[model samples]
Target: MTRITAVWTARDDLAAMLAALNVDGDQCRYVGGAVRDALLGIEAADIDIATRLHPEEVMARLETAGLRTVPTGLAHGTVTAVLPNGPVEITTLRRDVATDGRHAEVAFTDDWREDAARRDFTINALFADPATLEVTDYFGGLADLDARLVRFIGDAGARILEDHLRILRYFRFHARFGGAADADALAACTTHADRLKALSRERIARELLLLLGSADPLAAAQLMADCGIWRVILPETAPDGLAQLEILLAREGQTGALPEALLRLAALLPTDPLLADTVAARLRLSKTQRLALGRYATPWPTSGTARQIAAEVQPADSVAPWLLLRAPDAMVSEGLKSLEGWQAPQFPLGGRDILALGVHAGPAVAKVLGEIRQRWIAEDFPEADRVRQIASEVAQSAG
Candidate 1:
């Protein structure tokens, strides 16, 4: 009988939709992460709703009530209600008729208890009726959430078999909750760890990054290694990657830097650019992510202002000193500084300037300009006057 509420529920936009969905009596409730997070005092980014109304009726009521709706997954009895606060995925209550460890064929039902039973974890099954703002815990979701425990709803193995990705989700949720993991869940995840290969590379990569982005993923990562999950998934994992990850985490904590999943991933992999490329390709990572991983693996120059290195490396954000904190002599001092005022200084002299300095407008002019630019960086990026002087000297020398 826990009473759960959040500012989102009381928002004008949400109130209008709530009224629309409940016009036929109590049919919709705030569900999933929003309800779970409201109780935990964490702001949820997404709001989901579980409704007893059928998908078609749900859409009709929303449209009739002047709310925009998207058929996000009507086959699965789900509709997306777009509100000013955010788009809420309103799913008609359903029970899985069959599951194949990847997709589930669900039959729509009006029973909330059956809906709750179909969910993966106990803590995720909690719901709150918008009519009364009272939480409805069909299982022991309230107690589990209070204990910060992530327990499977019915049977752990059954849940894992139902969705192979649940193997990774167990560790991800466990790491996020930061509590003593459920032994049964842990065991189940380990037993079916190979099932992770059945999942898409994109899904595996996403879950791994989210896990890495946790406040402290060290223990969960070590647990994954112990369960042989890492071996099956990332064979190229550095033997010292976990230790280096701990070091990078410590450095991040000391510098008050937010966790970066790609950078953290770089810490967990052998610092080989080729290996980075290979692993990134296996994970189906974006080009930017792959390139950043390679740069993080490739050690930046041990000596240079962040600005100077950034100038040469182009996208200095990816090769930030801190991302290279694992490099030998990673210029720890420079890593300690902030990039707040950092800007890649523009080269003062150009090919035109060299031509004006009595150099012919051809390959020779470009040649002199290149020389002056190198001198400018070598001289620690002096003023324009210094650059023009350097340009004159280079042009004369070229002539």
Candidate 2:
């Protein structure tokens, strides 16, 4: 009697949508990650519905029931019902008509098991009766869930051939929930490791980032390297990168740093700025993300105090994660402590101030300002009076 009725019934939309869909028959069930997460006592973030109704019929009925529906992926048989909280995606049951590793041409079906069979992992295929909260598992998903194993739905090799992205998804789920990597699934991913080349870099990056964001990606990550999957797909990162990530993860917990994915990603790479840019471009990261990762790729400042370091980078506390990644624990503690309730004190003397000191409009103004700047930073960004004094002395010295 595995039930999530009390949990999901609290959401306003689920009950209404279930009522609408079950009007003629029991046509819809909560499916995929929502069901798996609910059963695991994790709050389901994304609610997906599986239905025997065709795509058009589902949309029609939802609208007729006064639920607004969006044809999110009509070809893939998905409609999104808007809720006050968030969107719930309702998808018609589908079977693969054809697939080429990267893409699947699917056809709507009335069979729930057929839909379940077409999914990637057993734990992902579990469906729950929204009314009774009874879980229907045609593929032993409940057993696998209880065992904490992330096994593929059918033959691992065959399932991967249907969608190559499943190779990455397999490791991701394994990292998140598996007791141990399923041997066949791991082997299949290794065998089809080359097929990962066929996937767009964007797809590969998305999965890798998600995997890196997992509770303990290092387990699955080390496995990938051992299986030669890493060398095949991402040669930019060597096996040693995992060692760095291990340290970074510990530092994150130690320093109270949020385990952010991109920041973790920066920690996962060698401290090579050029390589970070290459990887960022390869993944087609946004301009801001590319810059952030690239900036964090350099080694942390070794010579300065935390305030000085923070003053140098200025504006953003971008150095915190990298400091955690590279520096010793003592330095990390001091650096993080220095940053808390810290604002980047505005460096008081601009070139204009130097110019106003009659250092001239040319390179001498720049030169005196450079000296003042060094002293200002070395002095931990002093007040404007101190800066003006430094500027006056530097200008006088320059003359």
Error of 2 at 38 (Å): 0.7
Show how many residue pairs clash in every candidate, following the order shown. Answer: 0, 0
lDDT of 1 by residue, 299-327 (tens): 65656666666667745677554344554
Total residue pair clashes for candidate 1: 0
**RMSD to true structure for each model, in Å:** 2.0, 1.6
TM-score, every prediction: 0.94, 0.96
1-399 in candidate 2: lDDT tens per residue? 677643665777677877888898789988989889988888777889998988788888888998898889998999998876789898989999999999999998889899999999999998888777898998988889989999998899999999999998988998989897799998898889999999999999899889988877878888888777778667888447888888888887776777767877887678898999998999988887887788778887669887777776732656776677777677988888887888877666677787788877888877787788889989888888888888888888888
Off by over 4 Å in 1: 321-324, 327-330, 336-338, 356-367, 396-399
Pairs of residues at least 3 apart in sequence or in different chains that clash in candidate 2: none
Off by over 4 Å in 2: none
Cα lDDT for residue 27, model 1?
91
Where does candidate 1 clash, by residue pair?
A: none
What would you estimate as the lDDT of candidate 2? 0.84
